[model samples]
Target: MSQQEHQAHSLKQHWRDIFQQGLQHSQSRYHAEDFEIEMAFYGDLITHYQSQRALALAEVQKKLPQPLVKLWQRANLANYYTRSAATTQIPLLPIYRPQQKASLKHQLWWRSLRFKDEIYKDLMIRLNRHPQLHLKVLQHFLTESYLYLCNDHFMQAVHQRLQQRFAHSSEPAIVVAHSLGTVIAYNFLRANPQFAVQRLITLASPLPYQAMKKSFKQRVARPTSLLGDWYNFCADEDFFATQPLDRAPFNFQPQIINQTIHTFVDKPHEIIGYLQHPQVIRAITLE
Candidate 1:
């Protein structure tokens, strides 16, 4: 396999192993069946994004000169670093707490498994040292956001998928959107007000972020199509969900119910972590 392919494969396997180990260690909270389902979903998402990233990079390389492409990439890297530095004011909460009598090796293992705020700081330091990995991560985020927000073809495909899923059904739908999916769901519901929506649940959403809100290029408001309440769940450690949709711009007649809950320490931003939260489960299943 090519170097890029090999790297992708290794990264995928690494995450799968981490997730499996986490599940095995927390068997009381999660089941074996949950592990299989989450792994399948995670694998599909990774594959789709990797293909999209390759296509985007290839298109850019074809159109732009190599020198300009490199300059653009450097600019993006610099911008990411600046933003990360500015955001350091937000304190990172501690995730690991060991028994006083635990052995040093056991404590170290727990620290690795449950990444604390110090771990995040260490990761940022390492990313700064490794420019390639830093650029790769920045490109991944930028590529996906650009495709969904700026590329007409990509947006149309997403809209088509939503139409195929909901166009024929007359019953009210309950949308449980996570991270970037929350943005897509909101946009879809706003455009297609004909579809009846019972409840809109957004988990780990970035809607409250100024950059994300500005991308809409309009004032934010609740979707008229929504017949019921909007419930938004956020984790304290989820970087994407920096704030809840409770303040200005998001506030409306029927206020959004914003609840903060704890997720798995190893994967705070994962959908599986958000889905397994007691409050989130109750919000989705409760009548």
Candidate 2:
């Protein structure tokens, strides 16, 4: 094979391995100590998804129709960071007590100094044991009965961080959310009117209220009007994303700049294409 062909082959193989490793780690046994490692693995998977998605979205723009291409350019990659709190926590994960919290706080200061030991301690002592428990706990935690608790915790953290960075911002901030993260974003915006996040790009959001809530029939619905520009995209085969966003009880309306629903029949395309669309790129570009 020519050098170019060989390089392409190598790149494909590398991505395949990276995705496989990410899947393995995410599906691996869950235990207390493994939380940090598991989170790290998940982050790696998201990073891979984000980069490959950007590349794929770029390609889709070339092949698809103008209306369809508009969808890819508007999508935003959601980045996640986890922290602990005294009052709130994920339902399944055991809350670290005051002592553990104190210990962890001290370790945070030492983290840059003794990174290796800290990682090893978390991996060996905690991570190796939690995979099974995680499966059971996450199931319950994710359910409606308990989901609000989890969302609340996540929103508090996101807001706290956002405040620290842009507490007195004049312009609206662009907020991108993925999967369960969308719920957190919604709750955060609802909690604070002063926290004006302008544009919202939601990808593969599984929140049942998302798509369906926009109708006038729903008495109770997600408050979509809070954000200025809203764009929601979902893959055809992503069952979770397919959940009916248009329901009843609470009615909702969206301030949509552009929208598209993709059905990549043959295979999943790159997510970045959503961002490449002229409108979306223009909206997000720093310059």
Q: Pick the candidate with the highest lDDT.
A: 1
TM-score of each: 0.59, 0.38
Q: Rate the local accuracy (lDDT) of all candidates.
A: 0.57, 0.37
Q: How far does residue 262 in candidate 2 sit from its true spot (Å)?
A: 2.9
lDDT of 1 by residue, 1-287 (tens): 01122244453353344334434443335433442211111223334645756756655455544554575455343233123222212222232223367689877976674555344435444544554444444454455554555555566666676787686566787777777678778887887878898889998886765445424634577888999989999886554456788888888879999999877544466554665455665565552
| Runs of candidate 1 exceeding 4 Å displacement | 1-142, 214-218
Lowest summed lDDT across 10 adjacent residues in model 1 is found at 35-44
Best by TM-score: 1
lDDT of 1: 0.57
Clashing pairs in 1: none
Q: What would the per-residue lDDT of candidate 2 be over residues 1-287, giving only the tens digit for each residue?
A: 01111233443343233333333333433222322110101222223333433444345334444542342223211110111111121121111113344477566754443443333234322312454332222222223212233334433443565455555456667665555555545555655566666666665554553322221122444454355656666554333344334443222565333344443221112222222223333343322
What stretches of model 2 exceed 4 Å from their correct place?
1-137, 140-155, 209-227, 254-258, 263-287
Model 1, C-alpha of 213: deviation from truth (Å): 3.2
Estimate candidate 2's RMSD in Å: 23.6
Distance (Å) between predicted and true CA of 167, model 2? 2.2
